[model samples]
Target: MNKKFYFKSYKTKVTINGETITVSRKGFFNLVLLRLRTQVINLNNIQNVKLKEATNFKRGYLKFVVTKGLKHRNVTVIFNVFENEIAVEMKNYIQTINNK
Candidate 1:
């Protein structure tokens, strides 16, 4: 099954399937200025995952530490209070995959 979550405030979307996780940014500004292209990460390539719970004053973020070369690059998706649960779920799902 394919599960998708969208965070409107951050203009980011995360899609989880059995084998891969896909992340894409929405809006023209994010596409052009940020140069944030869609990232398709395989389950095997994820080194670690982190989820920061959202507070009233600050937005939380789900970060994926992807294995690239000698250094790791973080792919983060920001989420507000309303999206906290979904972000946690995504983190849990990735952890489960890594354990297997």
Candidate 2:
């Protein structure tokens, strides 16, 4: 059996307390990730925001992770334009392990 690898790009929306956040576009994952990192650590004083990873053709791949106050959540997803589909994997353990 051949193992299948998944990597997709898509926009992510995050809403908290009835507020909507906008995710960035493709080829801007690094910038977004750095911003989120700062927000999580309270360095930038960002209370809420959306982080997104987009793949621009053969250029490269991106990953995103966002953290807030006492709550931790990760949106693991893959998007394929060729197949017109989005795949997601949720790893709840990330938050639990980091809490220690």
Candidate 3:
């Protein structure tokens, strides 16, 4: 089964299936900024995953670090504290995948 997360405020959606993770963006502004693109990263190419837990004062983000010199750019999703649970889950899942 694919695990999915949607962050409405950021206009982004994330999906994890098998050994790959996909990040997609939506909304008119995001499209105008050329951020409305889909990025897929193979678990094996991910070097690290970071999750900055959100607090009352600030929002948090989830980031994926890919191997150096690769065509794939790093992926980041900004989210509010309410969305932190899924972000943490994604971070853990990716880390476990990289360790195997």
lDDT: which candidate is best?
1
TM-score of each: 0.84, 0.21, 0.81
Which regions in candidate 1 have their CA more than 4 angstroms from the true location? none
By summed lDDT, the worst window of 10 consecutive residues in model 3 runs over 67-76
From the highest lDDT down, the ranking of the candidates is: 1, 3, 2
Model 1, 1-100: lDDT tens digits are 7889888877888888988899999888677887886989887778889889998999999888888678778888878998888888888877877798
Cα lDDT of candidate 1 equals 0.85
| Candidate 2 clash pair list | 8-79
Candidate with top TM-score is: 1
User: Compared with the true structure, what per-residue lDDT tens digits does model 3 show for residues 43-88?
Assistant: 7788778789998889899888887465656678888888888788
Model 3 spans > 4 angstroms off: 68-72
Error of 2 at 71 (Å): 3.3
Across 19-88, the per-residue lDDT of candidate 2 in tens digits comes to 2223323435634663331112221223332323334553222233445667655433334444222222
Cα TM-score of candidate 2? 0.21
Cα-based RMSD of the predictions, in order?
1.8, 12.4, 2.2
| Clashes per candidate (backbone, < 3 Å) | 0, 1, 0
